[model samples]
Target: MGSVFCEGLTHAAMYARFRPQVPASLVNYILSFLQEKCKGPMNNAIDVGCGSGQSTRVLSSHFKNVVGFDISEAQVAEANKLEKLANVSYKVNRAEKLPCETQSVQLVNAGQACHWFDLSKFFIEADRVLVPGGVIALYGYQFPMPIWENKTEKLTKLFTDLYLDSLHGYIKKESLDVYYSNYRNLRFRIPFEDYVQIRNETLYAEHQATVADFVGYISSWSSFQNFQTQHGQEAAYDILNTFETKFMNELGVNTSSADTELTLRTNYFLQLGRKPTTTTKRGNSPVEKQTNLTH
Candidate 1:
């Protein structure tokens, strides 16, 4: 991922604090392939471009062991502050260059951060590290939106213009724009596409969010961070502050601490594939266990 996305300690902290997690149902969709593989060391999975471990922790519940990597040291540092799970570990590393031994992993997944990666390199690394028939899942949720009256809709448009206006030249072709524009054709590389079983879907998660939560979430965006950098922080935040005022006025709600616990719905674009295999041995099998394991 880019520096603006997860580089500095401050931005990294905000991202960790506000980013919603990969929904459990979506995680189940990825793990459903290996539902039988529930037990043992053969169920190793990797989460690439894992910023601050929100996605990593969810992956650990299914896989016997999970390794999460990000390019930012500060993001990894922030991720480590989350409650430690027995099966999860995080590190600072690149998505294109994985450290796992060849065919040593049962699954690989990335959440909300693949667009920043070099897809060709990431696919090659995934191919090298995955065991035959191992699964690779990449999924992302769009920005959460509060479902309110007409003012909520109009206010969103107003704030969105400000957000994009601030990001004039900083936009890149390979960033989240690609995901939002045409996720169906999001690029992928060899062996997996040709030989792997691949598919895509949308997943959902529901939350009741406060106005403060919504504002904090918006502040966590990479584009917003870029806006803060290009314009001064005060000028950037002024957009959000203005929106908060509009929100309260239009909705007839109190601005007590800028917290409005309103219902927000979140959904994800999920792209999943499995590596090809010659012989299939279900990992959950009571008797068949692979001797070679890497962590």
Candidate 2:
């Protein structure tokens, strides 16, 4: 099979495995942000790169009509199956070009999936579909929050080095910065504003997972899966085993029944931009609104 085909299969498998583990509270928080920012009932909303529709389900509560689009047909199918609301729908589509009518949507949102989109094209499409004063919200979260534990930190560093060394041309930090900059740049283009990062305070919930769960989450990463396929499963498993041993030793976990309590510290970006209005004559751009919250 072609490399592209193989990558697609790997991604599908990975998404299937991790779809259920996505925290419900996180989804509700994102929806709450949209509700508070957009103000009142959002008549129509679109979720780009919606995956298995966990986020899409949250969106359905706020909008009378909600449509979720993704590049993977398998994901779309899964999302459709999981959607319980009559107003929610799922389709297989790319972020760069949506099938919706121009200037028709009230809110356009990209959840954790924003990192995978082409920012330039996504913004253009967003601008096209949003009505005047409509809102565009892009957000994502980083997991294993503090990552302060010595073993976790070292394993993370090792994973970073492996990816960098294997994918010689890839720059991980620069890639992350793209999403950050994309939201930051919105201030110049539209009525851009954002929230400060907040640390996870509550011991919200805890779950235990085996080595397979770790591998499943890692495989969900397109870059890591591609790297594994190119380098071979033996090479990938070798690294996985090494990291597992280190992680277990540090946590005093038993290999026979290895399980780790996933403690997550989440930082999120709540970027909101308003579609330009005709009456809003050109003037010095308005100052951005920012709020910092902690619990």
Candidate 3:
């Protein structure tokens, strides 16, 4: 998890271009829960770890004001460049130290990016920033179930076994810890009363892509990028191409631009907690620490 944002323009650009939006159904699912439980105005939402503003932009349509925050200047810059919403803004801020007043936000969210935070610090900050009955949602999604047709699922299995699986060592161990428990079971300081467990859900996204898009999608992974940085780019992409070849050959195609429709059964793990209306010296209360890690 060192250099969580990862250096280089190419990495940031690839993330912005390839990371798919969290499926609308999932977004609506969260919004619906908040609307039902919130006791304050639905004025603003802070999208922490909102890399490339994909999740941030989604919130803008619902909340009157949406702000995206990330520690990377490059990520923040890229988000700003592609963003045009008048009420939406991007900031270079950490999840544990948001530049906001106490109880100023209606909702605080993390999209596939909370595993990186120091949980102790984050919970304190989340409590301090959210209004009474304000909701906090943390969620992450698994890799896509790459497919061209029914039988092609086997091709995806072969590809994962060969390429994606090889990058396991490059992935942050803390992320594995979170996944093993399912995102719902995170250790947090949110009091038991305010802890509202969201059911684990599997939402589907049927996306159209060329073979190159599929490759680019994998390239967006932090583990894949880390492998490229440590072991020359030529060596890393070579292995990727072999996996690509195996899939293309399965489909009886040889080009990277072949039209491929990928159906991703994204297993979304959502953990929701509400900020306590009665504060108990929130930030001063000591709690177990969380890893400053990321995907």
Candidate 4:
């Protein structure tokens, strides 16, 4: 698992360059939940696995002090270059052995990167670093929207098959459920108080995008990167071209510059759990048992 995670870090630098549009409504919902549930002011928060710091930047607005940490030095450097906030900083650090002192943080968050963690160790570290009544929130969701045209569907399936074949043990789907279940079983786990579904009410949005934009976004996936690297870039390009041709012919539109509307069905689990007050010391804290979340 450690080796897989390290390999993932190698490509983390590209994450922000292929930025996806996240809904502001979703961000607002999460921040509002934290403000209500957390004990202290949302002044100090830590973002774990903060690749490219997209989510971390959003967190900065709600928290007085926000630090985003990732294992990849390259990723941290890239995040540093893109944006600067008065109260937010980015660092390279391991999630299992966080650099923060005990009981110093008000909130600890992981966005789309919790699946790579050693959960038992991570929860312990989270518990250690959070003050009593400090809230730990974990949220993630699937990429691209659930609604798919036939051409897009074929391309997505082909990409998934290629990636699974390449990485024999990686669990691509169900990542959010896996992390949520892990947190639910922890001794200090707090019940989720709110749930948010950020979806477009209409099939189309006001802003338009071309088919090429859709293709580029899909190609930016980590799985697609592995597929291109292992199977050859020519093959990946061929598959993408075929899908794009199909869309153009059927829809009478070019994807790259078209004004087509796209909607995303993003589901977020906004959970807030308080740190236990009387738990054993950091070193002596009872280890949480591990259960297999992948099937």
For model 4, give the 10-residue run with minimal summed lDDT: 197-206
Q: The CA-based lDDT of model 2 is what?
A: 0.59
lDDT per residue, candidate 4, 148-177, as tens digits?
Answer: 454556545553453455333333444434
Candidate 3 RMSD computed on C-alpha atoms after optimal superposition onto the true structure: 5.1
Which scores greater on lDDT, model 3 or model 4? 3
Residue pairs that clash (backbone atoms under 3 angstroms), model 3: 116-293
Per-prediction TM-score to the true structure, in the order listed: 0.82, 0.69, 0.86, 0.71
Regions more than 4 Å wrong, model 1: 1-9, 34-42, 149-152, 166-168, 189-200, 279-295
Residue-level lDDT of model 2, residues 123-164, one tens digit each, is: 666766776556676655544332435555665665455445
Candidate of highest lDDT: 3
Write the number of the candidate with greater lDDT, choosing between 1 and 2.
Answer: 1
Clashing pairs in 2: none
What is the full ranking by lDDT, best candidate first? Answer: 3, 1, 4, 2
Off by over 4 Å in 4: 1-14, 146-208, 254-261, 277-295
lDDT of 1 by residue, 208-269 (tens): 76777677777777777777788877676676677666666656765552456776777677
Question: Candidate 4: TM-score?
Answer: 0.71
lDDT of 3 at 196: 47
